[model samples]
Target: MPHTKTSDEVRIAYQVRGDGPPLVLLAGQANDHHWWDGVRDDFTASRSTITIDYRGTGESDKPHQPYSTERFADDVVAVLDELAVDRTDVYGTSMGGRVAQCLALHHSHRLRALVLGCTSPGGQHGIERSSEVRRSLVQPNPVDARQALLQLMYTPAWLATHPGPYYTLGDQSMPTYARRGHLVASNRHDAWDALPAILAPTLVLHGTEDLLNPTANAPLLAARIPGARLELIQGARHTYFEERRDLASPLVLEFLDQKVPLQ
Candidate 1:
């Protein structure tokens, strides 16, 4: 796994693939780079994709204290600096979306466009996970966590057709120790007040049937960010990318292509 050392001296792991305009992907809470596997080829086919494991997830170094959205956002900046990418498109889901929003507010010059999937503006608009789900995430057994997460992440139709891949992804992803810290970090994040400061062209994608993070937050995000558009994937759940990649990928690619324009 490729690794980059942040200013804080934390080693972050990431993978850069394909060849086209750079598009950095940020995974959601409790997920690693593997979260993008189902849709990576779709994006990478026409865009350079960089998938990263956040500070306390996947192969990245897991630190015990000082876990904040601002710090994670800095990690994204560190990755971009290491890659020498002046400006690029950003795609983030769930907790990653929060980081993307933070990036726009704090590092607007680094982004050409932003895509947020199954995410929220944080603070009051973001849905809090049920106590049961919260408990499972904090405990973090790969198998138990996978099963528990699947219920909250995927719709019934997706669970039926792609059980194998979903299971495989869960098995390969979800680091026990790292995920625990990530879950704790995510619970503390609230960005509702900061949405209006984001200046990049923004797209918010949500699943209509999403249980984990309600779709109701999409319009709120769109209304806040200037020129931000909202799209709701019908019958989709939290894992909209994995479940409806055909629908989600094309929309995302088109949006990025239109706003950022690959060279």
Candidate 2:
């Protein structure tokens, strides 16, 4: 519920919980801080957790203007500044991973370790979701599109066990322009050329069965970021960190535990 102001004066909302070394949790496209609900306790048990709502989502001020991953990274830095957190580990999912890429690139000194989950680097080199999968989410009926998204997010078994009327992480009632801005920013992310320059020790985590950001992109990210480690969660989909946290959280926590020589 705390807030900070970006250089451009947009109010960014964030929450800090627990105690110890700081770990920042970045949410995916259209989602807010609540996106990390499933696995937050794992990290917070040993590290302080900082969850942020990017400029256009959650309780943050949403200006009807262009949004870029680089700008979102800056918004994150502003929150860290407000809290006097000089360096911290980062774990980002989906579009949040793109913003994390920008953070590692543009603010390398501010990071300790980085974790990227179920995301792509964007541009021509990255593997995109199949046309069939993409089309499923853009259906004419909003209800149908949401159902398609639910399918992509989890396996049929999980969905069968958890009945819906449940909404996704991001509020559906958000301004249409904010959603469009998030989409454009995510589409335009291209950190391939600059990835090797990243100083933080990094981990790339992806779902083996992710339909949104195809799993193949995981290796590309691991190969590009210097000394980055990759882990693929089997039988998992786009929100695997939530759906398969038993497999994913331990990997993230163990990676975060290893010491990296300070920059």
Candidate 3:
């Protein structure tokens, strides 16, 4: 229930947990802070975790206007500023990864390291989904929207293990207005060219079977960034964190704790 009122006057809801260096978690399209629920325990064991609801999502204030990725990035900066956190590790997924990339390019000093998961460089012409899946997301029902999203985020193997959690989380956190705003924001995002400017010690995690964003994005990101490392989670999809936590968590912890350049 904790919130930060940004300079732009948006009330951003966030949750901070655990103890140690701060790790901010950024959720993707139509997702709220709860998107990191499955990985919270794993992360909190070694570091403090900050999960936020982007403007127009979850408990955050939703303003009626055009949305841009830069605005969302600013929203994140505002959250960190409000918390008085000088610098911290950032973990971003899908659209959240785009925001992270923007932050690294625009606000490099605020980050200790970066973790980009199941995301893509936005400027490219990426994978296209079937019409059915696209239509279901824009529908009014959060449950249906979540089901459609999960189908895109996770592989068949993952869906087999986790069936109902995605829908329940969506129903609890996703709202129709927020979803529309996120879609609008997503359409406006473009970060492919900016990847070269990111200086943070970066870790790019992608699912080999990710349908929404192709796995090629991992190599593209790793190649562009000065020293970014890429890890492909085998048999995993966009939602690899939930599907292969056993494999993903250890790798992330090691990368954030070890690979990041120390200031």
Worst-scoring 10-residue span by lDDT in model 3 = 165-174
Q: After superposition, how far is residue 70 of candidate 1 from its true place, in Å?
A: 1.4
In Å, residue 31's CA in model 1 sits off its true spot by 1.9
Q: Write the residue-wise lDDT of candidate 2 on 1-263 in tens digits.
A: 77998999899999999888899999989888878876788887778899888888989999999999999999999999999999999998999999999999999989999999998888999998999998998899988988899889989998888785443446665699999999999999998888889889999999999988899999999999889899999999998987888989989888988754323
TM-score of each: 0.90, 0.96, 0.89
lDDT of every predicted structure (CA atoms):
0.81, 0.89, 0.80
Candidate maximizing TM-score: 2
> Candidate 1 residues 1-33, lDDT tens each?
988999989999989999998999988776678
Name the runs in model 1 displaced over 4 angstroms: 129-148, 167-177
Candidate 2 vs 3: which has more lDDT: 2
Q: What is the C-alpha RMSD of each candidate to the true structure, in Å?
A: 2.6, 1.8, 2.7
Q: Flag the better candidate by TM-score, 1 or 2.
A: 2
Model 3 pairs whose backbones collide = none
Clashes of each: 0, 0, 0
Residue 103 miss distance in model 2 (angstroms): 0.4
Q: By lDDT, highest first, what's the ranking?
A: 2, 1, 3
User: Model 2, residue 148: displacement in angstroms?
Assistant: 0.5
